[model samples]
Target: MKLTFWGAARTTTGSFHLLETRGKRIALDCGLFQGRRSEFFERNRDFPCPPADVHATLLSHAHIDHCGNLPNFVAQGFEGNVFGTNATMDLARTLLLDSAYIQEKDTQFVNKIRARKDEPPVNPLYTVEDVEPCLDLFVEIGYYRTFCFAEGFCGRFIEAGHILGSAQVQLDVEQASGAQHRLVFSGDIGRAGRDILRDPEIPGEAQTLIMECTYGNRPTEPIEGLREELRDLVTRVADRGGKIIIPAFSVGRTQDLVYQLSLLFREGALPQIPIYVDSPLSANVTEIFRNHPECFDRETRDLLRKEHNPFGFETLTYIRDVEESKALNELKEPAVIISASGMCEAGRILHHLRNSIHDPKNCVLIVGFQAEHTLGRRIVEKRPKVRIFGEEHPLRAEVKVLNGFSAHADRDELRDYAFRVQTRSGGMLERIFLVHGEKEAGEDLASYLREALGVEVHFPERGDTFEL
Candidate 1:
């Protein structure tokens, strides 16, 4: 089999890896490349492997970075079955469409500025029409179900406690010599025992193991402690009669915020302020979480059995229509509005921030990890001023970055999962390639995996391939 690292070699956004055997191809994940506008636009707009030759696509989860570029793949000539869990499919239905629309709108916004200066207009990577055709390829399977692709390759998806339906994929390939080779791709390893999702399942054993190390260099403090900090911040903002604007990702971060808000409401920690979820995609994604109660941990399951919906509390409203979404800015009352595009790159979040950033009384709650050079990162750094829609506005609102809400496994958690894989498979795990992290973080994680787990580590460059 031939395996290639096409994306997420030294950074986390785009996640693509290709495996080929028996004259057939299997791509692990087709995710968007998010960074600078021009770079991201060019990278995600095309497929590394000609979509025509690919046999099948296995999606790890439904987050944009992991599943965003699938529509673009379909827009190209790819027409194979897309594999994922039921929740991943559900998320894909909304997430991919939303991503396509964002791409269209973002490109239009950029081209509008260029047009003002007599520059040529840019085209969208894909459109809603492209997304409709892409959704036709989705094939949703359940956990532990063995899915066969091509003639001699079979793979299974186990829960990777990262999000509602994230999975760690294990592949079993049979060569012509009648010997089986095992491989595993840890897709954004999640926390060991997190809320609302079962802990990650062990994927038997493997000779070659590929894992993610997003937070591999940093130790994660317990998320349980963050409630107090969040409560304090919300209370202060409410008392000041200002709105709380939270820019979170539509899939994971949005759900986590709603769960935490439910807890705050139950404990009477937060004031009775109206809450609005402005992204339609998030509203749909939340419903997907509701449908997959089987994925919940025991505590969350028990809570659900008791008729306690942990994601929904009193005083919360989901706004979807354009008119309704715009109306949120008109209300001067103390409220919490959660919008998508976590890093303030696009989506309704920009409108929310543009409306509220100038008010000193408001609080901008940043709950997700922001990359470098993003507007969200600037806010996290508490920049005195920020530009939006070609205008500079004073960053008067207070910014509180809550790191506890991360989905990716931290340093210790990554090591724990790595060792657990070693314990399961009786064979010696050869090499562990760390992906989906910055250069320094990937290097640090590679060092830790070698030292702590006694596994040889390799950080491959883009287009690097290992013949197994």
Candidate 2:
């Protein structure tokens, strides 16, 4: 078998990997690369391998960075099944269409400027029309159920606990010599004992393991402190009649905040401030969350059993109409507004930040990873001024970043997971390929794994390939 690190290698985002076994090629993920505009366009505009030659794609979850580029792949002539959990397929439909819309809107915005300057107009990576074909290819498989995609190949999905329908992918291949090898890919392992989702399943034995090291260099703050900190921040902003703007991803992070806030309001810890989820994508994703009760953790299921909708309450409103979203800025009273595009990239979050950041009493709460050069990172750094809608605005709003609400496992947790997999493998785990992290985080995990378990770890650079 041949394994190739095509996309996410030394950097986070753009999680594409390739596997060739038994004369068949499989694409692991066709995720969009997020970064500088030019690199993002060039990398996602084309596939490293020929699309038609790939027999199938095995998706891990519906996160944009992991599944956003599938449409482009399909548009490029890939006619193969994209297999994932049932919920993943459903969420992917919503998220991929949203991603396509964003790409089209952003490209139009850029092209308008380019037209004035007499520069070449750029096209979107893919359009909504491209999304349907990709959705048609999705094959929903239940967790722990084994299926064969081709002759001499079989695969199964394990609960990953990252988000709804997240799974760890296991693939087995039988060679012409009748020898078999097992390969496991950890798709962004989630933190154990977190709210909403179940704990990540213990990985079984495998001859080769590909895992993410997104939070390998740091330990997450305790979850208990998250609610208290949020309450204090909300109270401070509300006391002064200001809004709290949260730029969250529409799918996982938005749902998480809603559930946590529902708990707070239920306990009377938070005031009766109107909480508006002001993103159309968020409203749709929240509905999907409700539709998939099977993905909920025990605590969330318990809350549901007690006649409470964990994602909703009397004080919460999901705003889908653009006019309704715009009306939120007119209100002078204190409220909590959660918007989409978690990194403060392109979305309604930009409008919310523009309107609220100039107010001294307003608070901009960041609750997710902010990639370098992103507006969210700038806000997290407390920059004096930020550019919104191509205009500069003073950043007088208080800024608060909470890491405890992150879904990814932290340093110690990742180490423990690796150790457990090693022990369960009983020394059969031959090679560990660490991906989905920056250079520093990947290096840190490599050193830790080498020193702790005496395992051979490889931090393959992008485009590097190896024979297994």
What do the candidate models score in CA lDDT, each in turn?
0.85, 0.87
Report the C-alpha lDDT of model 2 over 25-61, residue by residue, as the tens digit: 9988788888766687788876767899999999989
Candidate 1 lDDT over 1-468, as tens digits, reads: 788998888888889999877778899999987777668777886666799899899999988888888878887889999999888899888888888888787778778878898988878777888899888899999989998877788988899998888898888998666678889998987776567888887776788889997777888677777878888888899998999999989988888888888888888878888988898886677678879986789998898789877777778888889899988879899999999898888888988999999998998998777776678988998999997755688999988777788887888888778888888876568778889888878899888778877767898888898887
* Highest TM-score scorer: 2
Instruction: Give the local distance difference test score of model 2.
Output: 0.87
Q: How do all models score by TM-score? A: 0.95, 0.96
